[model samples]
Target: MMRIAIVGAGIVGLAAAHALLDKGHQVTLVDPGNNQQRPTDGNAGWIAHMDVMPLASPKAWRNLPRWMMDPLGPLTIRPAYLPALTPWLLRFVLASSPARIKSSIAALRAINAEALPSWKALLTTLSLNGHLREKGILSVWRDRNHFLRAEDIITRQKNFGIPLEVLQPEDLKQIEPALHSVEAAVLYPEGCHVSDPALLAADLLRLALERGAVLVSAKALAVEPANDAVHIRTDGAVKDVTADRVLISSGVWSRALAKQLGDNIPLDTERGYNATYAKGAFGLNRPVMFEGEGFVASNLDTGDRVGGAVEFAGTQAPPNHERTSAMITRLKRFLPHLDENQPAKRWMGFRPSIPDSLPVIGQADKDKRIVYAFGHGHYGLTQAAITSRLITEMMEGKPGSLDLTPFSAQRF
Candidate 1:
């Protein structure tokens, strides 16, 4: 058996650890802990298998100017970070071309096609089937024009063989009574979501631990490759951990570590903000994406999670709870009964994003012993299981079914 070390204990890292452990690898998960509001803890846990489209689309670029006008809109970029973000923004614009969008969709769909089944298999193995909810997701629209414009995209989704249902105003109530009357809604019947993201992360880690996987509760400082082993230096009392292989899955923090291994990946952070209220407060049978608003609300076991803005602020930016407030303010338009006075738990996390919307998931350099698997962005939860399977196959020297070209670290 090989000793494998994973640098990030978020959803992706933990999932990888579990997969490797099931394959009889001696796994060690290296993370500083979730005190900094890990993305796994705060995400609107949608297993978005049908969401093959990338955010960097021609339509999104066209709406950029108007979205930027509203500071608290679904997409925001801090003024001070603009200069540093220019390079990434340029690539993002390039990725929005029709050709690039089509390619991104195909690559995303390739992985997402197995997302649900992989999650099911993993969850079944872990005996945590109840954690995943397949109630599906509703993409609701308030504006009549916006709803009408959704037809083209819906047509495209149908062509992809995705199970989708268009719900008119009258049909909305039967699907979700909590939501107020809307112009229209499209439901992805195969879409899934977690009952509680944080709990899922915890359970996955706990199960990994139970299966003889070690949890190194320290921040990885550096990774050095020696003759036969990769050494990981960390901040914990145990200064270093040596392993036969190392998988860099540290989310947004992975860029620096991958660079150490001679791979300068163009990974950036998509700072996401969210607000959570007491359980049963915002009643919803399934997660609902408020189309055009750049936010989604879901009823989780922990509470009702709201807010999902794509903020371009760097990793060090302070948490902006105001974005959550704005989302709540606008949400009242749909859920008029929403009590704004209810206390909310605010959170912010970084989603490691690539300009092309594809994750960097392959060998860092010539050494196949070290693999890179991060930059999943919003689909991290949805793609984690499939990523784990692919990376396991990679580390085991087996030829994986999916093409690694699109997810290569050097693609940038």
Candidate 2:
């Protein structure tokens, strides 16, 4: 059996570790002790198949000014960093062209299509639903013009056999009484939600430990390909870890580690903010997306978590609790009855994003035994299992379950 080292503990790393272990491989998961590293604890916990489009679409450019200037806006980009990311933005615009978007949407849809089956398999194996609600996700638009604009993209998405239901304003009102202000809604039947992603990951960690995988609280400093194994150096000590494979699923930090091995990926973190109300604002039967606002909400037994914001500066940016409060403010507009009196537990985490807003998933080089499963942006929760199975397949000398052409490291 091949020995593999996975460097991250987020959904991707956990998924990879699970897949590797199932194949009878020796796996070691390394993560820095809770300080400067990315945490998988704070996401809104969605496994959506409807959000198959890249963040850098035509509409992004149109809304750039407002997203940048308004701190409370759903999307924000630091103006100081714009020049450095201009080339990426240009490429994003190019990729959002009619032809490119069609192709991207196709690939994303394929990845998304694979998500449900993989999730079902994992859920069955784990025997813990832990709020694995298949209650569909709905995207609501405030005006007919917005829905009409999205219809073009929706038509192309339909070609991929995605299950989408377009709802009129009146129909949307019945579905989401809290959102009558919206003119229309698109319901994605295949979307999934997790009440608590952290609890889910904690369960996965428990399983990994039970399966003999070691979780080290040490930070990896560097790696060098030694005689037949890759020698890993951590902050504590240098250890000769002879592994046949190394999968980098280290989120935003993966870029630096991968760069150490001659891969240059321009990865930026999408700093996200979330607030959890211990007592739900109102009874939400499912997850809801506010399109024009770029925000989302979910009702869970534990509480209602309202979140959304894409500020691309760095994950370490100060916790702009004001932004989190603004999300609550925005929600009040949609669901007037939502009780804002409950104590809020605010959270922020960095989602590593590429310019095209696609994750990097594939073998780094044919000659080397390194694989990449990082830069998943916002879809890490959605694409975890599929990426794990694909990466594990590649490591086992078996063909990857899907075409990895779309998420190659060379694209950067």
Worst 10 residues of 1 by lDDT: 57-66
lDDT of 2 by residue, 269-383 (tens): 7788888886546556788888768678877656788887887666545767778888788878778877777788888888888877778987665336888899888888889
State the C-alpha lDDT per candidate.
0.88, 0.78
lDDT of 1 by residue, 128-198 (tens): 99998889899988877877776777887888899998887778897777788588888888888998988
After best superposition, candidate 1 residue 271: deviation in angstroms?
1.2
lDDT of 1 at 409: 86
Q: Estimate the lDDT of model 2.
A: 0.78
For candidate 1, give the lDDT of residue 378. Answer: 86
RMSD of each: 1.2, 2.1
Task: List candidate 1 segments past 4 Å from native.
Answer: none
